[model samples]
Target: MAPKAKQRRILVKLVSTALTGFFYTTTRPRLGEKLAMMKYDPMVKKHVLFTEGKIK
Candidate 1:
């Protein structure tokens, strides 16, 4: 059998819908899945639901 994948964290970008501000974070997706999280956007000055989207 093949060895397990090494744990690795990569940088990701999350953007706010209201202010269009971007937040940078890291995530480890071993199975190759997108990361979705609800975090606080400082520019918006509130909590918002941010999903995995293209940075460019």
Candidate 2:
């Protein structure tokens, strides 16, 4: 592909990612929350146990 076309494609991809991030934060925030929960649920349990031990 030509350099100009490649640059345009990259720009389009960047815009698409930005729009998706905006929509996730504004319209579908629960999706981000669920993702966060999934990512952290395991660590949260471990953290709680570690903190409880530290208090002893």
Cα-based RMSD of the predictions, in order?
4.5, 17.2
Model 1 TM-score, all chains together: 0.55
Candidate 2 C-alpha lDDT tens digits along 20-50 = 2211111222223212111112323321111
> Model 1 misses residue 30 by how many Å?
3.6
Off by over 4 Å in 1: 1-9, 54-56
Residue-level lDDT of model 1, residues 5-44, one tens digit each, is 6766555666565657566556655467777677887776
TM-score per prediction, in order, is 0.55, 0.12
Which candidate wins on TM-score? 1
Q: Provide the global lDDT of candidate 2 against the true structure.
A: 0.19
